[model samples]
Target: MEPDIATQNDSGQDSESGLSLRWSARLSLTTRILVVNVLAIALLAGGLFYLNNYRDRLTEERLTQARLQLTIVADALSSGDIANRDALVEQFASHLGARLRLYAPDGRKVIDSFELAEPTYQFVDPDAEPLRKDAARMLDKTIESVVFTTQIPNFSEPANDVAGAWSELETAERKSAAVSSVSYAPDRTPVIVAGKSLPDGAGSILLTANARDITRIVRAERASVLLVILVAATISILLSLFLARTIVRPIRKLAVAAVRVRMGRSDEIAIPRMPGRRDEIGQLSRALSDMSAALRHRIDATEAFAADVSHEIKNPLASLRSALEGLERVDDPDLQKQLLDVANDDVRRIDRLINDISDASRVDAELARAKFEPIDIGKMLEQLLAAREQRTSNLGVHIAFARPAKDVAKVMGDGGRLERVFGNLLDNAVSFSPEGGLVEILATPDGDEIVIHIADQGPGVAPDQREQVFQRFHSDRPDGEAFGKHSGLGLAIAKTIVEGHQGEIRILDRDGGESGACFEIRLPKAL
Candidate 1:
């Protein structure tokens, strides 16, 4: 057997709810906020990678300077006596802060600056450095690896410290021009070397410099940039979380409250209305709270209406049942006829009650969807009076309308509903008026509103019962009038329709101190 319809509907709803949950869970608002904030810091941190190029340029400039100095020294030695070359090399090495070496045409070590004078510079051994320096080296190595993707060969002395072991010197001799190369020291500092061929093929001069300042400057700049990025990232994350809390928390609360309302647990839920906030979220909260209150009111009113309908309907049903039972036992023709009349009246009352209840139940919905247009209250009342005169011989009760000036009593409303309102009031006035009594209608413009008054020469309603007369099934008819002739919903429905049209209706005493009830209606004038 197929599954029950309710079970199928439940499963369908569950699947849809699960799909929504999964979709929303994929990326939370907080994560999205964090990512958007952090992305800016990441872009700023990209400057760290550019330091590699900066260091390379610094090393290349230092190597160029070394090459120029070596060429000058070799030129000076080539022009001078060979005996003074060692002293000149020692002097140049001391002045330039570098190590100088002279090579023969056959790659033999001719003159060495270290042998003639004290050493100019030496490389620091990284393994013997302090922890802080080790960390600096690690950072330098990491940056180089990330940017260049390849390691620079470590700088080292030639085997046996001979001239032939220097590759740049051979390259300069072969090319007959200055050449340079660079490598990294053990401490992650740059070591630059340049070579120049001696004039007239005498030999070649090789100069080596430990350009540690280049690495120091690049690492210093990188550290500063990283520090800025770290601070900015921290601030961005904190602010993102703050924004999410302010935005997402309220929305989550609304969602939870809405879910409770949808689950029929609204009586236990109090939707928060953030009155202090002036933002869109605050507006949304207030709107939702108001909507929830309206929904609750509608539900309570519907329950009350159902109960009232049951009570009202039961009375007529009971009377009809009693009359039918009496007709079954009564043998006399007069008694049977009387019972039949009673049964017919009860049936008519039941029919009228059902019709009024149906109309009352749907009035709100129909008015909500009704399209309103400008209607002239004067013309409408005049036409209503004419039609009533034609349809019913008012038993000597006369209706006189003091129509307003042209365009003075125009209002925006559904014409049919407005006509029904006037028609109900007119019929009520006629029913209560004595024979030959006058019913008067007057329409006039009062500021932005069009006011209409229907006054009847009848026993006026008591102050205590004026409000009660508009309630459903309230039948305080005039003396000698048949009971159940009116469903008592006429005034209630009139009040509902007037309120729907953004108007008001109230009972009042006639202005002239005459003993009659005056029903005043006020409707907003059409612009």
Candidate 2:
């Protein structure tokens, strides 16, 4: 039976030779890694999006501030009345705290605040003052040329240069309009350019301010966000690998161990018992180990049972064969009857042995599936003793029982199996007791457990043979008993049932150095 089970279980697995692997099954590890990185990158993308939007808002805000100043200067220059035009416009530009310039309708440079304030500048007025020596050469390699815009050299050299030269001032007499644009100077400084045509198209006003501060802040912020995202993504990948190693490795180990156990490599192969871990994987490892041990135990027991059954059945078969052979040869009728009687006894013995063996084989399975409940050992014992008294009334031996205190004898187990166990013990005791012997039964609570003692006034078991009495087919019945009266499986089955409930049973020394056997059963009390 054990070999059959092993073969049946492994045959299906071995036959799966074709490796028709599906993507989901084969790519679990890859899936884990991809999932982790995808989530991390998504967060990074969100942060970048936010930074881009923030940069746009800041740029617009700076442009709006420049526009406000440009509008103020344009309105002041276009006022209805004026006196000392150059001085008044210079006062307005100064008060507004911006670099301001005015152009006439013919595109001629009008009032220039930079020229007025810094007359010493070599290129303050391009027509009035000769261009600076370096500016006049228009070289691609000069301090001011490299850092500030070379175009519009009449204005103060800016801190940064735009990417390329700006569009020329074509169509000067085109239309009255206000326009705004952004540019970087040769020094990489951002500049906001605003121009507004004055009321009635009298002239145009232009304003230029360094927007380097805000642009620098935005670039720095972008770099910092990218750096943070890079570091986080790297760390997340490493951590994800560590997590996969911790989880996937143990599971694979368990799978390997199971295959080894199933393939008959060894029964007690070491299983990794990651006891320190309290996670789900840890729990899974432990469960697998436990299941392996249980299956091995069951297989061993099944094989042992098969061997024992074969050995036990052979004896009756041999006797029957001898009786049949004798009956065929015997001449006298009495001798034939004796041989016939011998055959009958052997047949009955074989029947009894087979029945008992069948029950013993199924006991384990039944107990495993049995639902348990709280039972009052005292009440069960009362009923058992009554039944025994009625059955053995005509016999010489009498049975007696002592009830336990209320609630003291309660235990958790299958009531029917527990009853069968005590019944077997009582029957065994009665069979050995002398005529009119008292078979005493007692139940009581012993701390967290309930203890039941069944003592009979019969020959006590030897200390050495006490354990052997509970073994299968261990028949050590007393003399004068009818042949085939007992199958010697009762005590074995009783012990099995007791253990199924996580309880214990043992032969105990009789009180007062008595000449009788005492069986003690202990069970955990029901909560």
Best by TM-score: 1
Residue-level lDDT tens digits of model 2 in 359-459: 88888889999999989999888887777667764167877778887777999889999998998898898888998898888888889999899999888
For candidate 1, what's the RMSD?
4.5
Judged by whole-model lDDT over C-alpha atoms, candidate 2 comes out at 0.73
Each model's RMSD to truth, in Å? 4.5, 9.7
Each candidate: what lDDT?
Answer: 0.86, 0.73
All candidates: TM-score:
0.85, 0.75
Tell me how many clashing residue pairs each candidate has: 0, 17
lDDT of 1 by residue, 1-527 (tens): 44222222545655455445454456878887898789988888889887778777787788888778877887888898888888889888999988888888777888888889988877888788899898887777787777764567889887776667888977887788889888888787878889888887777788888887887798789889989999999999999999999998988888878777767754767689999999999999999999998888889888888888999889989999999999889899999999899999999999999999999988899999999999988888888778878888466898888988888899999999999899889878988899999998889899999989999999989999888888777788889989888888999899999999999999999887998999999999999
